[model samples]
Target: MHAFVVGVAHYPYVGKGLGTGPARRLLDDLGQVTVPEPSAREIAEWLLTAPRQPDDPPIGTVEVLISAPHPVKVRASGGAPVEVESAVHENFRAAFRRWLRRCEASRDNVAIFYFCGHGWRHGDQLLLLEDLGEDPELVLANSVDLGVLRARMHLTGPRLQAYFVDACREVPMDLTLSGSRPRALVDVPEPDGPLHPVDAPVFFSTAMGHSAFGDGGAATPYTEGVIAALEGLGACRKGGQWAVTTSSLAAHLQNIIDWNQVGEGNQEVRIEGQWAGRGVLHSLAGAPMVPFRIGCSPPGTPLPERVTARAMISPSPVSSVQVFEANQGHLSAGFYEIDVAYPPDSRFTGDTILWQIDPPNEVLSLTVRSRLPDRS
Candidate 1:
């Protein structure tokens, strides 16, 4: 698998104090857990040396680009020091694009993109890059759009693609600006050509319009859970090796954050896109349990106002209740019918819905068919 990883704690032009103090301070204290550097480093480490059963296919050439500032100093023979300026937007963007080129050359491989930094989602998701001094208001231009990035990477035709974003999508409300909000440097262009369907699973630390917590003085709960899960902990053992699909890992990651009460309010982690049956992320040794499959239909069915759908839980008796939106209903030992009512104002056209089952931390994918006649 090839990886492009970035973690940023500072932006030179965006005034040192941009967002919430507590949150910023958490990141500043590198040793205090919620720091971005450690999280980025650990995640890259795991991907580089992914643990697998001896019988499983050996991992292929793993390439990575990590852009987080480390305190390590490098001295040159001529007395000049070599410093890594990772946060610069232009520098990081070049590195990211280079990684994409390498990935394109190796089509038959798994690709992963991990970004942990100060970011906010607008139009698409943006990862703030360190750039030469530019207007603070034009931060968007210096940033990279995750949606566009995903599309470009999808063109490489990797067997599997995974994106992990660990950043706060919160806007800095207290900032003094010349206008209501800043505009993106490059106007987000209309898709003039065919759009590639994103089949990879994307994971976020928190839901929309919320913040993710790092280190209450330890490894931020989100990254810690991910590391533990990837390390073969809490995974179901299958055929002498631990079994964990990408979907199952998503549920497990969510459970870890929720159980630990990581973030404030409803800091639910979200998993989007599709993962085939037990989309095997990696298999190692852990607790022995078979990962169950959760299925929904008519797959990408559309809804007008109210719709009835079926959810089938394999191996039966998974959970007492199924959760969607804010409502919950009891599930029998097997399949159960669910009635969903979409609000009139809810703009769910071409959107993925997150369905969860407690006790058995399982996730099912369901899509809201687009309403536009052409989209249908």
Candidate 2:
């Protein structure tokens, strides 16, 4: 497997004094971000240390380009930490070429691409690099045209390719009015030979004209979802083993994201392309631990101060009980007898609910209602 990751957090001409005159003003609204660099680092670390199945090919290389306010260092597999290249157009082109060459060496290789940073939509998705407005006349000279890149990837040898784009897809008015389009790094020519059949799935963080959300000093919400999906949350029992396929991963991502929202506006995840077959991204050695959520119904129902929730596995050799006071918890795939208790002083009652937790990242909201006294 070969992975290419790009994270741009520092745009020199966005809000800085890198470019003079009108070109810099065009990017006034696109400010510096603090999440993409860390998000990319986390993904790279996971790829370096993640366990691989016996039948799966080993990870050949993880190429990362990060643009940050200060120099950044990353640790490769079994090696000392080294400084990574900046996410400028030249560096990205060079690094991507190297990564693509490695993927072309083996037909059984898997190619993964992840990008997190400022982006715009103008008929095609434009991924901005560090030196976006470096040239006064050509503001988008350093951006990348993602649409062309996906089409050009068909020439590669890797049959399985996945792309995770964690950026906004809002259309910029300036680009549309000025009739400027971003340029693709690779020049794709008409195919002459039989193109290798590919199963490439592109996952976008948001829908068109929507902006992706992220907190300062933390990874973006979409990045967190992707990592969780990779860590067995997206796996499901298929044929005798647990595997995370393209379809299952997409479903789990939406479920997990919806469950995590707390009064925040919904972010619709958009997925493009389809798998040629069942594209298994990751396979687990055992049953996956599914996430379960429990809450009261009727929008803002009050609960007792001393409420307790317990889940006991059924038909098990040994008695096992998991207790929690929060509304969310993780449990291994099994049939469970859930019991909730409330304080006598409170006007709420408890009930025993039966649940079957089998799906990956399964989110269930167990609602306990209040018992009303009879007038009679």
Candidate 3:
């Protein structure tokens, strides 16, 4: 497999003192933040080092392009001024084109593309690059169109291609939020004929036109969720084997972003593809760890008669507390949920609940709080 990761943290013309103050103000109003360059490094490192299936071949090459303002003091005749350095703006296109050519010849490997940056959607997703557009006019000349790239990748016959984007598609001054949720779905022409063979799966950090927030000291919420899923935080077993696939990873990421208050439901992750079965990305090498999913109201949130909950346990969960038994006959094995309705007068007193599993028995504790008396 081949992996290419791009992270852009500094835009020359979109921010402070660049003759485009309005653009910066709009970005701030829309909740845009500078993406951390370490995110690119971390993702590339994982792609290079993540455990692959036991029989899968090693990744041939991992390419990374971190686009950020690395200050370099340049001495001039009058004085010294600082210049920003970036390789993505200088060589990324040529390097990627070369790789695309190679893909035409090879035709049988997996490919991964990850981009974390500022972007806008105008008929297509446009990745903002380093070039300084006409200030105030703000023509997006130095940008990459995601749709065009996807179409190009379709021509290259790789077994699988995966794309991850962490960017807001909202254009400045574009207040309309109608049709803001970005969808990666592809429509079919007919009902049952042979569909187009575009074996690419994509994951977007935010719904259409929404901003993807960045953490000050950590990776963006989206990348953090991806890292957690890849690290087996929410892994599930299938057919007695511990593994992470595109489907499972997507589900885990969505659950994390939605249930953990990661982005308060603003930064929703969406995954789209058409693979018949789960596409395995990594295999847990005999690690005796039980992966499970849990979701409910936070500890202090109001308690309802019917608190909805869902779970997926790998390697068989022994038992559960404050919940029902696992239905072994489920079409999708290892999946369980809690939909029990409590009596109207039932008394509850506790700060937490427990979920216990075995083999390497571990208990997961979830804090809870009853609804406070109504204040007049």
Best-performing candidate as measured by TM-score? 2
Off by over 4 Å in 3: 16-33, 71-90, 132-138, 172-196, 238-240, 258-265, 273-277, 287-376
lDDT of 3 by residue, 297-371 (tens): 465443334433344467654454234233111122223443434345544423333233422112233344454
**Residue pair clashes in candidate 1:** 34-214, 34-215, 87-130, 88-130, 89-129, 89-130, 89-131, 215-220, 242-284
Clashing pairs in 2: none
lDDT of each: 0.54, 0.78, 0.56
What stretches of model 1 exceed 4 Å from their correct place?
16-34, 54-85, 171-198, 216-218, 237-241, 262-266, 285-376
TM-scores for every candidate against the unseen true structure: 0.59, 0.87, 0.64
* Rank list by TM-score: 2, 3, 1
Candidate number with the higher TM-score (2 or 3): 2
Steric collisions counted per model: 9, 0, 3
lDDT (tens digit, per residue) of candidate 1 on 55-119 = 44445543333343344222323445334346565556566656766666754556677777666
